[model samples]
Every structure is written in structure tokens, then in C-alpha cells.
Target: MRTHNTIPAFGLGTFRLKDQVVIDSVKTGLELGYRAIDTAQIYGNEAEVGQAIAESGVARQDLFITTKIWTDNYAQDKLVPSLKDSLAKLRTDQVDLTLIHWPSPGNAVPVAQFMGALAEAKAQGLTKRIGVSNFNIALMKEAIAAVGAEAIATNQIELSPFLQNRKVVDFAKSQGIHITSYMTLAYGKALQDPVIGAIAKAHDATPAQVILAWAMQLGYAVIPSSTKRENLASNLLAQQLQLSDADMAQIAALERNGRLVNPDGLAPAWD
Candidate 1:
């Protein structure tokens, strides 16, 4: 599997996973050799994820679990307690990584305050690392300046074939900031695109596989979600699928700045 700074590049996204679905998905993913699981306070399924992990028979040390703090929990006082709640729900003492879900524009807490809280959480063993999600270049710079370079591990964002995000990806690479690409399949839209279909056919793979391979080739960590066993299995196999330079160029040409998830009302301009 591809890895970025020691973290696995391929993970199972649990954005909308819940109850038995989340539990079964976690169990299936773990059994399928997925060491990374992504959850969030907003996902409302940490409890199920925890239950699945507990039942999966996988050692906690061998798994990399990630959770995120929602916008309402940004206050310094609220941060740690919120994390504790997440811990309880996840059934773990410490997660591998914790992220700020979104930088709420008007309610945006000072990077120093919350980042300091995150650092404190690390020191207290609440999480092994801390990072942010939906953060653009300016916010990432501010966060690094506030939290110190070594403390910021990653910046998760919406990235896929249609929204390549080359500028931010390039900037993150320069700063040694690894990126986790959520919505890497464009919420399943890319699976039906004619161009992607042709590329997948050329490689004897599915369109989802082709798009995911492209993301992996560009060195972005990917988290693609699916409820079906076949989809999950196919997605994991994306690691072994290779796209030629010409294929990559064609995929790159599909970028139209299309975004699948834009809770813009919850945050400022992503760019």
C-alpha cells in the first residue's frame, strides 16, 4: 500500500456510514486489510465504528483511527471534552489523528487557541496527531504558523478527477503537509463518465478503480466509501492498478473544477 509520512494512503471513508452499515463496513474493511478508518463527530456513527473495531479482533495499535471535531466544538474549553466524547464513542483512548472539520468563517476560532488545545490533546495522549479538514492554503499557513510546523500532520480536502486541486496539493507538498483526499470518486459520479469508463476498460478495471488509481498516482491519500462488498473490494485493489502517463494526462483533462460536496454555507471559500 502507498504511504505518506508513515500514514496509509488508502482508507475507508465513513462520512455517511451509520449503525449496522458502519459496523459491518468497518468489520469488512478490517478483514480486507484496511488499517485506516475515518470517522467524524458529525457522522454520528463513532459508536458503531467502535463496536466494529472491538469485534474485529484487530489490535488497536495496528489500526489507524481518525475522527474530527465539528465547528461547534472549536472553543478551547469545548475541544478536549468534545474529544473525550469522541473517544467514548470510538471506544478508544486515543485516535491516530483528529481534525478540525471545517474552519467556520464567522465563528472561526483563533488558530492559536484550538490548535493549542489539539497540541494539548496530543500531549495528554488523546490523539497521536492533529490536522484540519476543508482548509485552503491561507488557513493552512495560519494553522502551521500557529501550531508550529511539526504539529500539523495533514490537511484533508475534497479532491477527485473533476476537482484536481493542484495548487493546494503542490503547496502542501512543498510544506511537507500530506493531503487526504475525501470524495476521491466524486460521490460515485465519475464511475459513469465516458472518459473514465474508457480508461477503466483500457486497464480492465472499473471506472471507480481508474479514478482512485489516478488519485493514488498523484500521491494524495484517498478515502472512498461504498456499502457494497464488491465496490469496497474493487476500491482496495486500486492500489495495484497503474495508469500510464498518457492515461493520467487524459484524466487530468477531465478537471472542470466540479465539486461533489460543498457545504459552503458552513465555511468560507475553499480556495
Candidate 2:
């Protein structure tokens, strides 16, 4: 239940999960002692996640649920309505955190408008914390400057053994901006990676576990998703697997500026 400064370090990612798959995954994760869960409007499974949480029987306060507003909802006018829709679908009064899914480049709405909406949401108790996702260093600077540092809490992005994102990570650390590493498993690509495999074997853990451990060691929150019960259980065990400094160094060398979640034109330049 450790948080990255403020947000939790380990959470269940419900990115591609849908229908009964998402429901079962959330339920299984909760039963396995997972306290954080991440979802988004674009993921199209918020309702399923909501149903699972309501049925889990865990008190609402014990869970830290996070969801995001999609890029289409970035405008000031669209912000609250989008969040309200998400809240209704999640069957919750308010989320633990709400993030701007992406920083749409050259959009008509100013960063201030979106960030202002986020602040208003926090003030109105729509979410306890407000953050951004897929924002680079420049965008982060603009966001903090506009919102004032205290208002922004985190930046969720892709961080794994292959795509290290060192510059952004270091900047975030220096600025005391928490980060949530999505695609920590690299969309199942890392499981077969030779470097990650060797490291996992050395630690007597799954590659996913090793990757997650690497992220944890760097103080970045991670949300790795899996539908199977065993995968979910094993992923949670990643918290207990500690990699040695030497192993960490070797894993660090494995970074080749690789990424698996390329959404083509839809995604902004991450480099």
C-alpha cells in the first residue's frame, strides 16, 4: 500500500480489459490485497470495474481508484461532464485521482483551461488528486507553472526496461512530481525479452516481476494488467522481489529507446 510520495506505487491496470474479463480481474486483484486500480474512459470498461469494486465487499475508503479524462474531453467545458460520466460509470462519488489522458498538441483550449478544470474538480471533490498523463518535460513545466506546483500530483506514462525515459523521470523526481509507469510489462513484450528473462531468472521471478521491481526501485508507481488469476496474483508478488544493484545496472543497460505502445498518429512524440 506504499504510495509514490502521495499516490500508490502498485495498482491494477485495466487498459484493454473488458466485459467479464475486467470485472473478474478487478475482483481477483482486490481479493489478492491490491488497493489501487487504474482505468480510463477510452478503455471502455469503467462500468465493469465499478461493478467488481462494488461486489468486492471492500470498504470504499480502503481502495484508491484512479481514472482519466480522454483527449476529446480536454476542453474546459467538456471536463466536468466527462468526469461526471466517468463517476457514474464507476459507481463512485469521487475517484482517488483523475488525470488528463494526454496533452493534445496545438489544441484550441489552453493548458490553463484544462488544468483549471482539474483544479475545480478537486475543489468540488470529484477527485482527491489531479494529474496528467503522456506529457513530456516541457508540457509538465507549463502545467505546474500554470496550476502552481501543489495542485498537480502525478504524470502517468510508459516506463519499462526497454523504454527508460530517464530524462523525464529525473525531471519528475527533481520537481517532486510522482509518476505512474503504465505498460510496465510492455504489453507482454518484456516477458520474452532475453535481457529481462536473464534478470528474472537471476532473481527467481517472472520477467514481469523483475520489470515491476526495477520500476519500484526507481520510485515510479506501476500498473500492470493481466486477466488471468495467476497473472494477477504473480504480478502482486512483484512487490516482494528485489533486484540487486548489479542486476539493476544490467537491466538499465537493456534500455534501447524501445516502446511497444505506439498508437501511431494518435500518440504524441515521446522522444
Candidate 3:
């Protein structure tokens, strides 16, 4: 497994998945050798995910669990308490990484206020590392100012073959903040692209593997989610696929700034 700084380079993402679907996904992923798992407060599946982990019988040290703080608990008074609640639901004492799901809507909570509280959470052992997701360049700067660049582990964003997000990636790299690509496959949309298909055929690999390899080759962490055991098993092999420089260039040309995970009112002005 590749790791960008402190964050695992590849893992499983639980976004829209819920109930039995998510439970099976997490259970199968663990059975297939996925040690890192990503969940969020809004996903409402932490308890189910925690149950899968507990029943898996894997040692806690062998797993790298990550959970996000919902925007509703961004205030200084509520952030740590909320994280403790997440820990309770996750059935773990501390998350390997804790992230702000998204920037507060309309900046209802200033960046410093929540960043400080997040740092406090780290000091209290609520999380081993801290990060922010879906934050723009401006918010990143404010976050860096609030807690310093070293304290910020990563800036998870929506990056795929189509929406490479080079601008944000560049700034995050300049500040030594790792970038985690949430929807690296663009919700299976990239699997249907002709360019990606040809590349997959050239390597005798699946389209999903080609796209995931492209993202991992670029040094961005990926957490692709799949309900099927076959997909979960196949996706883990992406870490071993190496793309040639020409192939990387070919995939780079597929960028159209395509972003698929933007929620109205919840998403910020992306870079």
C-alpha cells in the first residue's frame, strides 16, 4: 500500500452507501485485505462499519480508520464532543484520521474556530491526524494559518481523470498537504470513456483499474468504493499497475474539469 505522508494511498470509501449494502461492502473489503476504511458523519453508516470491523477480528493496529466531522458540529464547543460521539459509534477510541467533511455553509463557523478545536481534539487523542475535505484554495490558506501547514495532514477533494483539480493539488503540494481523491472514477462515469477503455485493453485490465491506476500514479490517495466483492478485490490490485509516461499523458488529455460530487448549497466554490 502506498501512503502519502500519513494518509493511506488507497482505501475504501463509504459515501452514499448505507445499511446492509455498506455493511457488506466493508466486510468484504476487510476480507479482501483492505486495511484502511473511510466513513463520514453524514454517511450514517459508522455503526454498521464499526460492527463489520469488530466482527472481522482484525487487530486495531492493523487498521487505519478515518471519519469526517459533519459541518453541523464545526463550532468550538461541539466539535470535540461530536468526534467523541463518532468514536463511540465507530467502536474505536480514536480515528486514525479525522477530517472536516466540508467547509461550514456561508462560513457560519470561522476557519480558525473549528481548526483550533480540531487541533485540540488531536491534543486530547481524539484523532491521530486532522484534515479538511472539499475546501477551496482560500479556505486552505485560512486553515493553514489557523493550524499551520504541518498540522493539516491532507486536503481531500473531488479528483478524477476528468476533474484532475491541478490548481488545488498544486497549492496543497506547495504547502506539504497531501491530496486524497474521493471520486477517482467519477461514480463509474469514467469507466465508459473510450479513451480509458482503450487504455484498459492495452494493459488487459478493467476500465476501473486503469482510472484508479492513473490517480494513484499521480501521487493522489484514492478511496474507491464498491459493493461487489469482485470489484473490491480487483480494485486493490490497482496499486500494482504502473502506467508509462506516454499512457499518463494520454490520460491527462482526458481532463475536461469534470466534477461529479458537488452538492448544491453544501459545496463551496471550488478552485
Candidate 4:
């Protein structure tokens, strides 16, 4: 079952993956049935992702490609052009979705300014959808004020079993903005939890599968990346893993505000 309408419930994420390593990951993922590929300018792997896609023999129309604009390009003058550069690198004329990589550092760029530029990028057909990432409740309000909630496709965040992010999740739900849960595995930390292990054992699934299923069951889109083919295939199989209500509650109790993606200057004051 897909989440967020057009967005796939499960996708391949490419963060901290670079060069041939990223290239191989994406190619293998596409072969393994991953249709959505997430990359960011900051990830420095868009071109590699594009290459893998171009070489994978999968038609462009069959794939859903997403890329994020880095903070340095938040300026109105730079947003669209930067996206165009990303498109060129991705070997596509338009991406399925594009996002603000992060909020303007210390409000260096106003919400309306960069968001308007992103909307214009959509208007010009540079991307089919536009959204934001790592935005807090206040920032989401500003984005909605700038482009209306209907225009923002999603708010991708560092969501995992250990960092449930209920406050941000609730706010996004109230406004009808979809949530995209990045790092749903908490960098593999949740896989080691005894509670998750018990649940996985009960279902005959991996801990990663349990966590990904939990997120998807909550109606959030997830993009979990892996360099190994076995892990990639297993993660995709997570779409079929169903957790019992008891299993859900057990995982819910594991939330202890564990966040692994916070960068000093680049991250915003989270919700």
C-alpha cells in the first residue's frame, strides 16, 4: 500500500553514499524493485544517482526521482537555477519531487522568498512537486503561509522508532501535509533493541522490517537506504510485514528522543 498518494510508501535513500558506492547502491536497488530514489545536493550523489538510473534500463516514466536543494541555494536567484543543475545531473528534465534541504540557517533566507522560487520551479516544470525538509512547526506554518499547505508535498524528517517526532507529526497531520520519514532505522540503532528483536522474532521479520512497517502503518512514506543487495531486498520486503497492535505499542515505548541527524549550523531548532 502506497502512502501520500503518488509518493511510494517505500523508497531507496542515498545519504552519505558517494561515487561508485552510491552508483552501485542505486543500480542494485532499481534492479531489486525500488522505484523511488532520494538524493540531495548536499549528499553529493545526484549525478551518480542519475547515472545509475540512466543505466538501469528502467524507463524514466517508471521511476520517481527526488532531490533536495542545499541551504546555500535558498536565495530566490539561486533556487530554480540550482534545481535545473540538479536536473541536468540527474539526467532528467524534471524530477518527481524537490525539497528545501533544510531551513535557511538562522533565517538567512526568508521562507516566502525561497519557497516562491521553488513554486516557480514547479510552475516552469523543473519539478512536479515541491516541499521542505527538517522544518519545525513554526517553519511549516511559514511555508504554508507562503505556498499554501496544498502546494507543499511533504516534510521529510529524521524519523525513527526511537525518535517518533510526535509533535511534528501531529502538526503536519492537522494541516494535511504528508510526512516522509527519513532515517526510519535510526542509523541501524533500533535494530539492536530487545523489544524490536522480540517483535521481529514473533513476525519472522527483521528488526528493520518491523520499524519500517510501523512507520508505514502510521501512513508516513519511508526511504531507507542500504549498500548491500540483501539488505535492500529485505527492506523492500518490509512493505509486506504487518505488526500487531501489541507490537506497535511495544515499539512506541522505545521512543526516547534519539536523534542522529542533527548538524550544528545546518539543522534548525527542532519541534
Candidate 5:
């Protein structure tokens, strides 16, 4: 198993991608040396991601795969079984990490119930680590109470230059939970910002690279996705694009509480 105190700092995010497109993206990512892959049942492309992994011949030991359990399957009776289904679709016996996709709709399911099931799944070797996504400060506290902070590997959330989410980030950090940034580029919204664009020009990097670098520099693991091979290849180089403190502060100033992925029922009251 890929053992680490924190989630991988960078990975390939498979959100809103499916069928041949996701398959191709994963395949290209593997070919380009990406070992960590992130997917969720709600994304509907676990099977394709598995197909690419299996066909790529990458040894299971070398890959770190993460999948999220949808809120619909949060019940104790359904959690582990749904995870096993995800494993089957991903062509893997276990996932490196598993997260609760979102809090149960209207708190229909108690946090302790599903978290207990998730812990059971980890104990049973279905997932090496357990975490939660889209969780705000209050929800994070509840999750920690359910399983203890030690069991939570990361709190994956929507964080980017446009939506810094420092309050949530600070809380997770205080609880010793690593933060993973999904949609770190703000769905290409940050790419057009003059601040990010200028930083990119200053460093001879793409706007996407500037934003990804900015997030990583702040210690949040980032999973930025792309369908094109060139974008995928170039984006990985963000790891090497270090930003100065001034550059980072400039990006921080761009935060306007601009959250883009909050679904009406799916998102909780963010901090």
C-alpha cells in the first residue's frame, strides 16, 4: 500500500469526465508518470478509469487510487458494499483512500453511522484510509468526532485562487487533517484573471500552472484534471513552478468567496 502521512500532493482528478474521454485522460496520465488517480462514484467513470489502469499494466502497488462514496450510499448497511462495488468497477481490490462524497442530504443519515461503516471498510482492507469531501468546519468537527481525527486522511474540498477557503483550511490544519483542493483552477475561471496571468507570464508558465502551483505552495494537495494530452502534460510541471511570497499574496487577494461547485442540496454551510 502507498503509505504516507498526507494525501499525495498532486493527482489526476476525474470529475465531469466519462466514457472514452476519461479513459484517454487516465491512460495519458499514466503514460506521463501520474501515479495517483482521483474519482468518485457520482462522477460515473470509475469503470473507465479502471480500464485504463488495468490496460496500462501499472502495478497495483505503485498506484494510489482514491474514490468517494456518494451520499445515497451513506447508510451503514450500504457503505461498505457500495465501496466494494466501486472496487469492482475500478478493477482493484482496494482503494488507497475513500471519502464521503457529501454530507447526507438534510442530515438524513447520522455522521457516526456512515463514518463507522467507513472505518469498518478500512479495517476490512477495502480502503487504506477514510476521509470526507465538501465538508465545512462544523461537518469536519462531526466527522472527527465520529472516527477521530487520526482516521481522517484528508478533507477534500473546492479550493482555488478565486475561492481560497482559508477558514476551512485553517480548521482542518488545526485538527491535523490534510486538505485536498479539487477544482483548484476554478473550472478555468482563474486562467483569465490578470493577476494569475501576470504571474504565469513572470514565471513563463501557463495560467493553470500558476494557480496549481499557488495552491500546492500553500500545502493543499491538488487534483487538477484535463482532457487534452498537452494540458495534462503541462499541468504536471506545476510542481516545479515555485511562486514567491509576493506572487502568493497576489493570488490570495483574488479570493472573493467565489465558490463554483456548490449544489443546492449537496453543499453544506461552508465556513
Candidate 6:
């Protein structure tokens, strides 16, 4: 699914946080050695994320920044321009990765149109890589057909112990597309599971660490977000936690098709 692991296995995600909260979170994550920062147009915090990165004094070359284009920007005419706006808000000339935030609702914009525009964005130096988010198996196939597998860097989706999304995962892996697991902790839901709790207790690790390690161990990239400095610091350390085969199998059984990010009108018919 990856060649040289272009996407970082762990990073910071900015979703609901805004203003000083997001600014502080990005700054804190950077101070804790986080290099990859994920944001989206709908997140409404790109400017603040840019502010934090600029203030952190971290060299631009050392960071991997990603932002997604909203569904409204899926149109061929709008996609590249929308990404240019994102670059301006991000205070950078180009983003390391840019994704189609979601499949066009009701096929309002065809995949080929937007994917071609995204390819243009890359060709014009607007982004280093291009991909999609919240895409199901069928949508992924359309994207691959539109841009070819090698052009699609990743398919960021809502995945966790609860919603293993094996159908989508298996298909993506088969197609050689990387899966970026957003809300990989299931928005903190899996942290409360007794199964995960037991594993964390056994390893003397936090439930978040156990979940993150489990995903990375399976070769999925995770972007878990936190606002508190302590939480952010501790979450970054999950990269070090390793779970045994028994632990992995235990968590795999935790799947129950639980998905947390599906939205009305915006979500596609999932795989």
C-alpha cells in the first residue's frame, strides 16, 4: 500500500477545534515532535493551523501538511482553485497532500472531473500528493479509474476497532492504496471498551496507545487529535507501543461495523 511510507503513521488531526484551541493543539503537537498535520476546508481551522505552524518555528521542510477539498469544491473548475485557497490559508506554497474531502453527494460532480483537476493541482505544484477521503470501495474504484492507482496516494476514512471497515480495507489494500484512519480511536469510543481496557492494562499503556499501535501494526496510518497538552504528548508516544499477535487478534474481534463520521446528504453508500 505504500512505497517508502510517504504518509506518516501518526500525526495530529484538527477537526472540531477552532481558534486558540486549534492553534494551541498544533503548537503543542509540534513541540512534542509531531510533523504531519491534517486539516480540511470544512474543518474551518486551516488559517489557525497555519498560524500555529508558523509560530512554532519548525522548518517548513520538516513538516508534512495535508488538507482536504470540500464536496462543494469537487467540480473541475473549483477543485484546483479551492486548493490554491487552502494553500493561501495554510500560508504555504503547496500542501504535502490534498484529498477530496468526500465523494460528491448524489454525484453532483463526477469523479473523473475532480480527480483530473486534482492531478492538475499536483502537476502545477499546488500539492505534492493527491487522494480522497470518506470514499467507499466503489468510489475508490472510480477514483483509481480516474487518476490511476499510483496517482491516488491514500484514501482517508473513518476506521477504528469498532468499525474495522474490513470490506473497504481489504479492497483498498488489494488496489495498493494506503488507508489513512481518521478517528482511529473511534472518537474515544474504543478507549472505553473492556477488551481494549484489558489490553492497555496488560501492556501498562493507555487505551489510545493500544488502539494506535494496533492500527499501525496492520500498516494503516492514523491521525488522532487532542487539545490538551498532556493528552497530545501522551498520544504521540503511541508510536512506541507494540502489541503482540494475541492483542491484535483481540482488538480485531472488537469490530462491529461501527462508523462515527457519516453525515446526512454528504455520505456515500458505503461498502
TM-scores of all predicted structures: 0.95, 0.95, 0.97, 0.97, 0.98, 0.98
Q: Which stretches of candidate 3 lie over 4 Å from their true place?
A: 1-5
How well is each residue in 26-87 modelled by candidate 3, as lDDT tens digits? 99999999999999999999999998899888888899999999999999999999999999
Residue-level lDDT of model 1, residues 101-207, one tens digit each, is: 88865756887788888888988999988988888888888888888656778889999888988888888888888889998888778888899999999999989
Whole-model lDDT, candidate 1? Answer: 0.87
The C-alpha stretches of model 6 lying farther than 4 A from their native spots are: 1-5
Q: After superposition, how far is residue 259 of candidate 6 from its true place, in Å?
A: 1.4
Give per-residue CA lDDT, model 2, range 1-271, as digits (tens).
2243298889999998899999999999999999999999999999999999999999999999999988788788889989999999999999999998887656556778899888888888899999998888888888888887566788898988889989888887778788889987777777898988988887789988999988998888999888889988998898998889998998899887887766754466665
Q: Candidate 1, 224: how far from true, in Å?
A: 0.8
lDDT of 1 at 63: 92
Instruction: Write the number of the candidate with greater lDDT, choosing between 2 and 4.
Output: 4
Candidate 5, residues 123-238: lDDT per residue as tens digits? Answer: 99999999999999999999999899989999999998888898999999998899999989888988999988999999999999999999889988989898999999999999
**Candidate 2, backbone clash total:** 0
At residue 65, give the lDDT of candidate 4. 92
lDDT of 3: 0.92
- What local lDDT does model 6 show for residue 47? 95
Error (Å) of candidate 5 at residue 129 is 0.5
What lDDT is reached at residue 60 by model 5? 92
Q: Candidate 4, residues 182-204: lDDT per residue as tens digits?
A: 98988888899999999999999
Q: Candidate 1: which pairs clash?
A: none
lDDT by residue for model 6 (13-106), tens: 9999999999999999999999999999999999999999999999999999999999888888888888889999999999999999988889
Residue-level error in angstroms, candidate 5, position 87:
0.5
RMSD, every candidate, angstroms: 2.0, 2.0, 1.8, 1.6, 1.6, 1.1
In candidate 5 the C-alpha lDDT for residue 82 amounts to 97
> How well does candidate 1 score on lDDT at residue 148?
68
